[model samples]
Target: MTQRFLRVAIALVCLTATTAWNDASSAVAETTLGIGDKAPALDIEHYIHEDNGFGKVEKFEDGKVYIVEFWATWCGPCIQSMPHLVELQNKYRGEGVQIVSISDEDLETVQELMEQEYPGKEETFAEVTNAYTLTVDPDGSTTEDYMRAAGRNGIPASFLVGKTGLIEWIGHPMELDEPLADVLADRWDREAYKEQMKRQEQFQIAMQKVNQLAGSGKFEDALKVVKKVLEDMEGADDPRSNLIREQLTAFQYNLRLDSGDRSEEVMTFFRDQLAEAKKDARELTQFSYNMMASMQQGTDLGPLAGETIAALKDAVGTADEEVMPIMYVLIAQMNASMSNFDEAIANQKKAVETSTGRTKERMEQMLEQFEKMAAEEADGDQDAEGDKAAEKVDAAK
Candidate 1:
């Protein structure tokens, strides 16, 4: 994910897990449309901006690449991705690649939004987006053909149409760079991508089965299935297989952590992850966050507490400024979970200091909360005839 996207996602959740494989795979599961299918026709009701010399596309002509994208006036991520899309269009326009971004909103709504001043800039959205084909399909036929037919329920989704007029790929527009480059350079593999989709479908099935087993209080059965799936998938080298493995690995550790009698097993899995992820700040923070997220009664990460906090601190030094607040807060929660209230307060203070706007406001409230809990703990200690009490507390639930 881009730093801009990470910043935005962090606004919604303190610790955003890497884009869930399930969400991406859902986009791949098709109804009447999918990758490798013929490109749907352009059903333009009003082409709002074609002034950059890229005229409105009336049809998917052979020998030309097209990016048929769906977006909206109210979608913030869609708006955030526009500049990058504009850059891509400008970069590839000479190569017969045209980007057509369509929205289902009325022309009035589209015009009102585009004419307004863009945030942090003096230009309007129309000016910022004028270099590409921006339009409104007021009748919803285009959206139904491309989006609904593919079982897609999200916007800012791009469909890459290859030179042969076949739909080459579909995904979030931000992730379009690599696939777009491949298609433009003739390095794209439709067959391998289909296999990737097939593997993802298989993994999805396994996940559903494991979840069912786990839900039925049969964690032992779930672990057995997890073991079998990993063993079966061990040698697959496709990108989707690798990603599924990563997700399954996460699921396995979380499963063990959630199983009440598996503390030693959970800690051992974490040790291996920590050793492998030590140099990667994002990986380490995700490891720590996932571990914290799995903690429940009888879930003991106490053995790895010192090392986990140390890894998170190291990550803070290397992480992006926008990513630091969440890492610090994760550290605070870990410490708070271990009843190390003083450390929790210290890290939360850092979280607040490094944050701004809504994140800062939220962290400040958390800081005050930590301080209050610490004071209450101290008072309880004093009330107990000056004897130290090892009262356990946890912030993650």
Candidate 2:
């Protein structure tokens, strides 16, 4: 009986090991779409304003020329592509082309986020809401369907679906102006567009997954996804693939700091990153340095303080007039972290003097608050000294 039980236990262990290995292999396996595959279908319940100026719902048509753009409130690239998308929608709406910018964010969250982003512009807000068919699918079934059908891997995935409900073209938004125009004009070959679609579909799935994770505050999980892509890039010869690797690294660094794991090691990590990053890498450098400064949390910035201060000072000398005010405020923040109150005050004062509109008022308020805090610190020092003298007097008595 003991021998029989041992044999059974060994067999179970072998089966479990085989199952774990298969799961691991499946996780990394790529399931990309190719030509002739039926495009995944989704029921996107698009929204528009009602006659009462409240809300109305419309479903996507089955056979129509449409572009469904997956984007988010926080995506910089998505934001950058908005004007072009607006232009495309305006130009194509008359041609039976439907352009819907759908998101996984719910209606209330979308409204609140839009309010913050659009500010006082009701016209622009309403135009965006209507023109792009800004509908939300909280369960993300639409997003999943799109990704699975188009082989999409990221946000800002623009799919040009044909009147036959087939994916004719899919790529980044930048490709829209040319390819979309050709596709709409009936000048683009279906086979060529379908081939390009497959390539982009394979390329974007990891990016889509990363965006999904990051949007949900799953930074660590996003990092893992990006890291896997980076690892897979070792043998790939694509320039855009290389760019994604660098961007993912920079994003992971920023997300790591944001997750409250702001140790000196993270600061050092960014410093090393800045050194290795290309000289033309302005945005990543700025993000890294800014996060590094923030890690100080108002404490004295030690040796690294001079580096941030110098970088800001150099930036100010050549920065465009529009960007100088922002640089000035960052410089002020660095000086404040060093406890150089006088220098901090001077920098903030420069920002206030040079800035216009709401920025100027905000900078002025910050300067005033910092000056008050400095004065209070001085008063507190005086009180401490006086209390020490009083203690000596009482002891003598």
lDDT of each: 0.75, 0.58
Q: Can you write out model 1's per-residue Cα lDDT over 90-134, one digit (the tens) per residue? A: 998899999899999899989988877654567898899988889
User: Which portions of model 2 show Cα errors greater than 4 Å?
Assistant: 1-29, 32-37, 45-63, 116-124, 148-153, 190-397
C-alpha lDDT of residue 263 in model 2: 76
Query: Tens digits of per-residue lDDT for model 2 on 228-282?
Result: 7777667645444555556667667666765655578877876675554324234
lDDT top scorer: 1
The 10-residue segment with the lowest total lDDT in model 1 = 1-10
Assess every candidate by TM-score. Answer: 0.66, 0.47
**How many clashes in each candidate?**
0, 5
**Residue 353 displacement in candidate 1 (angstroms):** 4.2
Give lDDT: candidate 2, residue 353.
82
